[model samples]
Target: MKRDIQSFLLYLFGFLLLWEWLRPVEQLTKTNHIEMFIIFILLSFAVTFLRLRWIWRTILKLWFILFSLNQFHYQDGFFQLGWLSSLFGELTNNFGMIFAQNWAGLTNVFRTLLFFILLWLMVYLVRYWLLNRKRIFIFFFMTLIYITVLDTFTLYSANVAIVRTVIEGFAVMGMLTYFRILAKENVTSDSLITRKWMRPLVLMIVFSVIVGIISPKFAPIWPDPVPFLKAAADKGGEDKAGTGVGKVGYGADDSQLGGPFIGDDSVVFQSEAVEKNYWKVETKDHYTGKGWIPSGSTLLRFGGDEVIPVFPIHSRVETRDESAALHHFMDYTHLIYPAGIQRVQFERSYDLEMDSTKEKIIILGFDSTPIAPDSYTVQFKVPKYKASDLRQTSVVDLEQINTDFIRKYTQLPENLPERIKELAETITAGETNWFDKAKAVERHFSSSVFTYDQTNVAVPGENDDYVDQFLFETKIGYCDNFSTSMAVLLRSIGIPTRWVKGYTGGEFLKYSDDERQRPIYEVTNNNAHSWVEVYFPNQGWVPFEPTKGFTNNVSVDFTNEDGTPAAAETTAPVTPVPKKDLEENSSKSKESDTSFTFNGIWLSIITFLDQHWKWILLSFVMAGGAVGIMYRIRGKWIPYLYLVQFRLKKKDENIGKAYLVLLGQLERYGLKRKEDQTLRNYARYIDTFFASREMSKLTDRYEQYLYHQKLPEGSWMESRELWENLIKKTIA
Candidate 1:
């Protein structure tokens, strides 16, 4: 009965330990309670039925079997199961279809194994090494020390969790105490009395509980021991997928480009513009047959009020139709702007810089600062060129082109295959104009010759030219491949072209009336794109869309008359608001906010809860199920624990405990031993009333041991026999 009590309490305490460890696993994997429930049932039942050593062995064997089956599922063809041979092949083949695909599946399996191992090890230590009271105390002391060590590594914010674990630690101490008591020898009923050690043990446990509850919270002095455990929990609870921007990586550094691409639709910025436009971040002139590189020229710095000198060719372009009205706000580091940005307005003064070519703008701040603005408005003049006008311009002679621009844009590695040049020449054979030649090269790639595939895009190997590999071999890739191939082909025929990188105008958002019904575009990292910029004589540099299905609106002008610049289109100028007008608007907004109250916030919360009540109920059900399963498992361990704790660990105290048991048994049979009566006197009264000498003999031995302090040889054995004889008679 005593052993059963110990086992019951120990089993219940095991659940607490299991819960703490499982909480950590939640972060690492999406293990549902059903899976945990199955594991719990298996382990608890095994502990109840199997010996300490066999339990661990059985768990390990089961784990190996499951793991092997999982591996067989992932293996190729029939050969994976064939290795198991006739002896194991039948078993392996039976479950060959069940494979562990995600980390969560694997994590759940591993966590189950770990939980069982911990339980078995704890039982082994207490049953085997915890022999005497001193050893039991030492074992508990060591356990407390380990708990302290764990405290340093646990996430400091989970004080409640820490406290619960500490309480479990006390339960372990209780278990150890019981185990020690159960290990004592068989007792003679005559010498039964409560041990003096019981009071001190109870006091110690109470003191420990008080200390655990009242201890001051302190900051952890070292790194958390299970950092991944906490990280896994936080991520496991989230509904989002994959790491953000970092996964799609930016194009600021060209060396990082030209690899497999994944489109992420997560919006990065929202812009209100006159029309959807290709927002350029920077231009890359030097291509190393692998990736592009900047010219390494110093950037020119300017204040917010300064007019950035962007255009070197001012005379030929008509500015009236080119001005694009836009208002942009984004919390991102890169300053994304449309093809032509002439002026900007900001709420506060900020430092800015333009690259050496004065084509791209860079918002300036400390290196650590992410470039963002509360809000900003820009007026850009996009050069509109008609296809008729571009088609009419004849090809310029190589010597007539700007020497510096020609040298940079026409750069190609010496090892570039000659076939590339031959192909470009063959495609443009009939085109005399530079514009037509460029268009012909662009058309060849934009045709069915290539297909856009992000995952299969081939990266150039060592000693391999990227453009050569893409054009001749793979012929399947995304924007970078098509754009780079066209740029390289155009350069082969003396048409200066450079690679430009930035985001494409993303999906159009709803129209905004506050900004006068301008179309809003939301751009994301998935919108990161690369294209070619062709330098046309006298008309300045223009963009060309070589990528299939993607249009560069800035490069295509439908309004131009035949072979001539179109009539300029004008835009309304935006005027700044006066200080008094801003103040009036702020006051009016404050007045409008008066209707919302704390009660309104509560109503919104209540409405949300009402709608999500099913989910809330499901959560409660899972929690209840977990608790119920643990309790059900606890039921099996209770009986064995009574024997192990009260019988085995406390054999030295049994003489006293057995006598108490007999007294209680007698009292239930209507032969009560009064609290005031001495054991010898009670035995005499029992003998007189029942005419039993068996009780008299037991009483004499008790008096000899208690009054004379005698421990004669075989005296305890004699007492045991006499007490049993009297108890048998009393029952009759």
Candidate 2:
């Protein structure tokens, strides 16, 4: 009963640890589940200490069988069973971009399989050896140590290690030992070999480990954050604007782009415009503990084969007089651009085509536009009035949206520190409207009193609330904390706000030629940024950046000495090499060091064993020195088979010596036998001594030599055999 309880507790603890690991991803935390897990762990300890032999014995049997099966399953493509998204998540978290970025000639799948096989084999051998000796405590201790060390290295290096096999081996060994002990205690020696439970238990443990090792990829139903083109295709269609733009073109698979940066960091983008610019994409409305996520879902539909909407009002459109006009065309066929687009009036229009199948509107034109049109004209109106103007209208629904947003925005942890709430209140004490309150919070955060740094984020624990840590002790954090805290504050005071992540500041470039002048943009990860977007019901979403002043934004100027248009001058900091590039260099250096170390150690050991093998031989070595060294380094004990083999060799030589002497004695009695004749057969042929007790003893000795398994040199069987032969010779 006690052993059963212990087994139950071990399972319980494992469940709880898994829950803790998964809680963040699932966004769930249940106290009861945690408590139950704790109770199980406690119970397991109790049972282990109480030595519940039966329960342990049964558990061991179960674990060994399960683990063996797990090894077999892992040898297959178990880890690749999940959907694309799940695979991507696991890859990102585990392998990071090391494998993704470097598409080397190496076959990753085969490499992983080979590694797994080797690991499994190593574990199996070690565990088998340990179990045979009934060293339960040593087995468990080694297993735990191996797992801890291997997991730590895997985490640091972002790769799987052979340590997993060690764990499997140890568990199997423990189970085997427990079962062996139980069998010995419960059954008589004659029947112990047939214990029915042993084989099945070992099988179960092997199976379990095999299953655990194969992690399948699971594709999420919805597109992750930014919808992928492939995922959209799978889903039939995509809603681009989340309003009324049916999925037109194939969704772009951005999985390779690396999911949107969750933290605050700047990304640089080269731009076509002479002056640098910032492009904002979608924003966040809700704040999970780690980062911002959309608050609700939105739907979008597109008009098929219908004329695009056009307003009647005439509006003037012109290229800036300072620069040449850039001629562009607009094909409103299947393309779904952002909403609020007005007119396509250009200084000089170009040829255009709409490819329905491709869902693209292609336009061909000169890089630079002609001079400003004499009378550029367009028929367009702003999609929505500015927020300031909409504020004057008493719209109940708009007010509610704002109110609902604020409630969620300002949401704080139930057990947040009082000082954090006080600081928030003080920062926005006099702010009346939601926008003003938001600005106040931003201003306080942007102030010098709050620092911006990445390394100071608090580790997870009670009293380690993100906002409190960032606002009080750390006073510094990257975009994650900043965006999360701001979103919370805004929601608290009735503001409809969401966080947004996209490229921010970028370098602008312009090229001029005889045919035409143009500009292009190049974006880098340093331009990645996070900020908040408040919903001004009528005006839609407008972005607000509180961390802007913390980092310098590069700008460009395009002016001549006379203040007339010339060429654009770009200004920005020099771009740095990517982090992966540095890591690769570091890895190369480490590999060189490791190779040297391994060669040196290997040579030294080989030399030592070659020279000092005599001392090893003195101990009745059955195997070569190299094999002995290998066993010693790997912590595997010498096998009994080797000892038996050594003894057999010695006994065979002794028998040859005795045979020579016996032949001499037989010759004196005129019964000399050929080398091929057995001594006992010769004794039977000699009538004088055939029926004597001496003949029987001689027959016994000869029979032992011909049929009996050899015994060790010092064993009684070896001595007795020699004595019988001696007695036979004396009687003859």
Candidate 3:
């Protein structure tokens, strides 16, 4: 009956665990649910029957069967029914469309079921095989590869559901291994795997977490040249590279010579120069039918480097004797003058050595005409030019500049919506200058309903007018939409605007010792940004990051002690602030509170039940009272449970010794003993036969030792053995 009850309890627990694991989806059709339930019930009954005799082996076999079933049907109720239908459907639709869709749906379901079953099988098989074979290295390697590949594939495929399943599987496998290792170590059933595997698993998990955290910075440290250009060229012919030849510009002829098309998050240039903000590659003055092209025809070949001269410089007659005194009249010393400055003469002249091999112009200084440094540090006459004089002068004609370049600014698609143009016009109507109008457009976007959301955004495709979709329907997008919309609006008004991509300033980490000390910078991928670069006449390209909520009023004030303003100060040094350690403290406090709360609740409930119950209640009350008294007395009862368990085990072993001793003592009295009777029963039987005082005493001692007092180690056996030897000598 006891064995039957134990079997029933085990079956109940196993069923509950299985039910929890196979949580059913709510959106399944009623018919599907009924079918699934029937299948599950049948499987459950089979499992229970098998479990009665051999639970572990039956589970392994069931998982294998499920895997086989999935392989046959794709687990989605789809099979390779007919090739002819698939081929016909594909041809009618367009190239493998039907087959691809069917395969995708089928594979999704198959992979889900396969993943679960395989994970269980692998974990069990590895553990079982490891126990017998002890091949730890092979098991570790195989398990690592299997898990890594499984996780990577799922992630790449963007199957979130499968990824979660894989994580759960890993956790279960880790737990199972822990328990099995503990069992092998011969720990008591009540003891958990916390001691055996918890520490090691935690260490491994921490290491993995650390690796994941730092991997992005360490990986992808190198650059990859644009592959999109090559892909476009292959699809379209040489003419495709130039604009408007194919669906996407591909061939060199079609490709814009100055740079790529200015998309939403276009990268202008990336450089390591500390002082330079923009790396100007080429300027467009000529606009062809398609887009802008550089007009400068004089390409000076200095070695292999191609230098396009934007400005023409002519007269340089003499080196000034008082050039050194010019530095005292300057406001700042770090200014870079353009190539056209004629008053500044060369201190030295040098032969321009063309190094085709090294791809650079090497200028050697000679005494004949001292070389003026090609890249020289210069002092700027800043205060001499008033704010009015700082305004840019336009030299090129807007109409004569390559009509193609200007076309990009005015050419809207034939299907361009009227509302979008009207919206742009309304926002910038009051603004007069191009820069002011651009600022107004930027303000409208930054202050409007649009939000930065990566998940909500859509990528541009061949046929899709992604800009229209973003503005009208999806009101949320990333930096791409924000910059793209701004650029288009600026171009519509005949203002040259280009998109720029880079990173933003990251979170600051300050030093612990000094409040004023410089802090370390740690940038992350999340800092990746996109903004706009508007051409300011004299300023060249002035950066405006509208997505960062930058406003026209946001300007740096560089003042001195007497409240006089300074010029030529371009860069601002970012200072870091220390972050408060509140998260760490809060987490620690939560853990401590949770532990105390759990222990308190348990103790309170146990105490309440003890006070109300009858039979075991008195014993529990006594134990509680004893504990309280021990605390009051400052006595050590915390270790009392361990002491009691030890004493009980000792008593059990001594009982067996007492029985053997009693048997030997009985033989000394010249009485035959029965092997089957216990010491207490034999003593009762012997007490009735003998009425002597010694016999009475022996009977009292045996009764007291058996029932009244706990047996001490070897007490009965030693006393009996001594008494029997004395009796044998007297008999002899």
- How do the residues 64-183 of candidate 3 rate in per-residue lDDT, one tens digit apiece? 445444453343432444643543444455434445675454433344444445544543444344333433344444434444443342222223333333333344445556546555
**Comparing 2 and 3 by lDDT, which wins?**
2
lDDT of 2 by residue, 1-732 (tens): 644543443333333332232223222222122333333333443444455695684475334433333343334443344333543454454454455665453344333333334433443343334434544455345545544543342222212323343344444454555556666777443335423544555566667666656767575442222222122222112222121111111222211111111111122223333323333334444444433444454333222222323211112211121112222121112222221223333445543333321223333345432222222222222232222332332323644355555455445446656776567678888655555565578777767776443222343344355566666776655554676667666655556666555444333335645354555434444344456665554444444556523332211233344766432322233232222232245345546764443322333343354456688676556556667687554312222332243345544435434444445545554566676766656766653543445444545554565566553454434544544444344443
What TM-score do all the candidates reach, one by one? 0.46, 0.37, 0.30
lDDT of 1 by residue, 1-732 (tens): 554554555555555554554454443345444344435444544455344576575676555444534443334344455544542543343334235334343433344445545654554454444322314445445544544545554533444666676666565666565454544544322212223444566577678878877888697543223322222222111133311112242435555334443333445677777667777777878777776777666677777567656644334655443333334433444456666566666676677777865256766555524366656666677665655555655756556576777788788767779999999999999887877788788789767778665444555767778888888998977777888889999888777888887767766778877747877767665566778888876666777878765666753453545534443432222222221232245336546876543323333344355457799999999999998997665434443443344434323223344455556556655788876798878877888877877676765555555566655665555456565555555456
Poorest lDDT segment (10 consecutive residues) of candidate 1? 236-245
Q: What is the Cα-based lDDT of residue 608 in candidate 1?
A: 58
- Compared with the true structure, model 1 gives a TM-score of 0.46
The parts of candidate 2 lying over 4 Å away from their true place are 1-120, 123-146, 151-271, 303-421, 431-435, 460-463, 507-519, 537-539, 548-732
lDDT of 3: 0.40
> Model 3 off-target regions past 4 Å?
1-155, 158-400, 409-419, 429-436, 448-481, 492-495, 501-530, 534-545, 551-732
**C-alpha RMSD values across all candidates:** 24.5, 19.7, 23.3
Q: Where in model 1 is the C-alpha error above 4 Å?
A: 1-246, 311-314, 318-330, 365-370, 387-400, 555-732
Q: Which model scores highest in TM-score?
A: 1
